[model samples]
Target: MSTDLEVRFKNIYPGKYFLSFSKEDLNTYLKFRSWLPGEEVIDGIEKAGESNMNCVLRVRTNERSFIIKQARPWVEKYPQIDAPVERNAVETRYLGLMGEDVELKIQTPELIGSDTDNFILVINDLGGEPFSFLYEHNSKLTGEDCKSMMAYISRLHQLKPVNFPENMAMRVLNHEHIFHFPFIEDNGFKLDDIQSGLEGISWIYKRDKVLKQKIESLGKLYLGEGKALIHGDYYPGSWLKTELGFRVIDPEFSHIGHPEFDLGIMIAHLLMTGHSEEIIPAMSRYSSEQAVDNELIAGFAGTEILRRLLGVAQLPLKLNLENKKALLDQASDWILSGMIRHE
Candidate 1:
């Protein structure tokens, strides 16, 4: 009784193969791929964390533990939403390229092995918790923490690899959510379900033609190519607080694009989580070889804020209706003015 996903995955390999949560099934598949030694015995299997795009599992063996990730034809968090399975290939390429830099290599997980045909990746489990706690009310990211986060991204942008994956599918999907869907008048996503009076607050921006035009322009910039390598989904969720230090994961949405997209995402999250005080200092800490366009960063940051507040990919925000409206107002100002006003 194999599901369509299991059947399709099996066809890609010789033996019966499909990633599952079952310990026995994972052990057999790992052994077949030589990812696990024949003698190794599976001790347990558990979910790694909250992942949106892929099935991520932490496989603990008698000797060692590692992570197994597989990308299917749909988003793992929301299966009805279709996505590209080849996104894993992009992540594999990003990891390979990052490994070339000493600083970046230290901050990223070691790529144990990969089966591109099955869209699976195996990497050493960097035991840690994601910085998702920042989403809680009144939570704050320390100065040192902000510094480390900025340092990793700055180093990552320094990479100048030739012929990177275009990642057009992921980009298109992201483009719709970030730049288009949330602004649509009747998109069917009920904002009031997330927060009372949120739907009313959202209408202000949805109807603003000037703001939408600016956002459309920024979206075009996002789809275009740039010289720097950006960690496409560079936020707290992808950042891990390990015993060693801060480690970054899930570069599946990565591409050669504007570095401000990453910085803007970071700024947006900081502002959303009540870390406004950290924004200016954090921006000061970010050191890029090329000049960063602050206005572009502001536009992207504002767009990210709107998308999170109004779109399907919601955060664990504890803001009240008033706070949300204020944020929306600020976001609109940032977008319309092309400036980040921290007053």
Candidate 2:
């Protein structure tokens, strides 16, 4: 069945070239786009990391290595899930904007080139592991890490762009997972499969009409436009830890949105990773040029926590059933009260 599916995926898009893990195929594709000079030979190709959205590869040459990302009609991690291939253009535009800013350019990977027809983006690989290890038991982000992350986001929110991709398709897809799908009692996703008793624990919120109503309202706010250009998915997975400092990547979901959306998502992850103490301090590190609405931030934070617990985008959480229940309850409270209470 998997072999058949692979064959079908390869030929799914007529006239559109799909990237494979083969060095020969990549050499042809890269050279065609002039991304690889004629003299530069392709040494090898390997998976860059665990990318959930696109096919990301590290292309090694005699001199150096670079990363190439190709977006398909469906998600690279979950082929059954549909996503927009144009996200490559969105990310390319974002990187182009970042390249103009001195601070942002230093913190993000350099965009080498792009193949618009194939939805492929070639970027200079910033070698380092993501900050995802913070999800492990006893792992915590240092004060410096928190400050750097906050500072990058703070600067990102301050950028003023004349035109930007609406990214409504990506936003709508995220809206379903973040706000609507998790609350559905019969969404076909089994929470217990992720962890025992998680299904039973999720019912406490799923059955709550008031909580769902609040989530629905927050969903509308998320789908609406805002003044700031915010990174749509500002989580640990998108943050890279390198020798210089923390670098940000994957702005495919980025759009003109409220700054609180970014702040709230970051805070939610910090809380989940047992860094609740860093929440207040991290906010302090954020730029005060734009006033942050704590209530809005709390609402988005709570929503993100609930979705990660009950939605398809499950984390590498080390918490047990009891701990998850406590978090679900706390997330509900934060959503309803519009206040972040760490206890």
Candidate 3:
């Protein structure tokens, strides 16, 4: 990120790129340049990931282009503070562990570089590539692709959780308080909106009367019965398509939750994107009564993410919806009714 290089890059790709890069981009690269003693001109910064604060730059030295990812924790110039950047480093390590089983395929760029603090991961950004956010097209996922995603979950689950770090449970859940962020109310431990969406199974937090008590109860059940590493954020944006098949990305939220937590939420996202509600049956292929059991996941997701959208961790889906009051109303209504009718 030399001064000259940054200026030149700005001039070259100056218009609306996928994500924007700025003067600070130069500072990150320069710091890495000094740290790497002999590393020659870290390649120019071209935008990579879908996130605004994420910068995917090319690191060229010996006739090779290495992808460098600079992920800042806070929302860029956002109104409120955001998630920690250290989570990106956690994701890098999580992917490495997962790669041991999946071989990572070619779908993921090589994880050749990293700066643990700010989460600057250098990879091989294939030009003929689209990230996961772009891949969850309307019913674009087929039976095989669906199975592939499911199988990956099963395999990760099969990995003896005992083999992980000593404090495996806490490490997996990380105790990060995501469910409460976007909500405007301060109603104790229960997320009023998330709790409101339960179609039938409503004895969650109230069964214990105390959130810590409820969390302890859920923790016991989750650890005792549920047997998988659930991707806390398994919505459409967490995977990608490669020459061979599909590969998942963004394991930062790799928490140990109910498997349906991942599956149902994904199906919910598909429906949100206007996929035929009839495709709801497709969810069953993953597990027994998956659609019903995981319903809470989507129910919670629509409610929770909607809050995030209204808060700080907004996604492109919000922009796509374009602040339309009608769509927002429909989303809110969808959560309450639990009916996803194809538009």
Candidate 4:
């Protein structure tokens, strides 16, 4: 062991558990796994490539370039903010489990090293465009792009769950199928916010008790339906736009949840975009192109709704509304109508 190893570790990561490796070492291990080619070139290294909610950096050695991703258990900006560290570990665990199962239309970063404080990943920077950028430009995902994404999602759900080591205990699959229970503990949900959100929804929330009931019922289906490994945050931003096709990244939220959780979140964001008429055609076209059960979509929608309200990461639609009451109301309606089973 190098006498100064701890000193170097402290210089790179302060107050955190971490693993650091040189490109030569990283390459040697890759060859041991028969994953690296012989003639790779080293390039200049650059630092920091963060966006929206992740911390990223690039390391280009003669061998290859890898993107290092770090997940902050607490809110990145707000240190006092706390979220589950298990979320990170869970994502890594799921990726390892899904190794042979993933059909990569979009690329996922290759994992290199993993441990408690943080993990190091060496991934292909496929130059994929961000989903928010696509939305901002009003560029609807072409039927082809939609096709690939849907196919990947379908394949993910199609995989057999029986292969996994039966001990993980994903009890969420039980009949109860709790929604937002873990997050509601320390952080309080404001009643006024609910009232404000309800009001902004233009009484649609109050008028649609049927939708609410549907959401509740679907929650059961969500937990009990076909089980598989999922890319927990299957959003546009997690994908790339290229001549080759969509390359995916950011599986930090990955786990064994409803396939609908992945599907509903994407659809909810799509619904939030464009006006009512535009949204209908988009949803219809997407539904036509993708093979899915409306009942399942409704169930996933319910999960999406609860996730928006209580999940650590908030949706962009809510952020755009600006007016506190109006945003809450719109989000409330979004869950009830867009994501809820009743809708």
- CA-only RMSD, every prediction: 1.9, 1.7, 9.8, 7.2
Pairs that collide, model 2: none
Candidate 2 TM-score, C-alpha based:
0.96
What lDDT tens digits, residue by residue, belong to model 2 across residues 72-112?
Answer: 87887888877887788899999999999999999999999
Tens digit per residue, CA lDDT, model 3, 1-343: 3455445434643531222344345535545446334544444455544543345555544445555565443433441334355566655766556556544334445566565644556555554343344324434566676677666654554454443322233333333333332332333434233333321222322232343332333334333435455665666566666666766665666654567556545654554455444345555445533223433444444443344334334444523333333344444444444544334
Clash count for each candidate, listed in order shown:
0, 0, 3, 12
Clashing pairs in 1: none
Best by lDDT: 2
**Weakest 10 consecutive residues, lDDT, candidate 3?**
199-208
Q: Is candidate 1 or candidate 3 better by TM-score?
A: 1
Prediction 4 TM-score vs. true: 0.61
lDDT of 1 by residue, 1-343 (tens): 1376566546654473457888878877888889898688889998898888888999999999999998877788776678997699999999988777888888899899999887899999999889998788466666667878999998888888889999999999999999999999999999888988899888889999999999999999999978799999999999998888888999998999999999999989989988888899888888889999989999999999999999988999887899888898898888888899964
lDDT of 1: 0.88
Looking at candidate 2, what is the lDDT of residue 219? 92
Alpha-carbon local distance difference test for all models? 0.88, 0.89, 0.47, 0.51
- lDDT of candidate model 2 versus the reference: 0.89
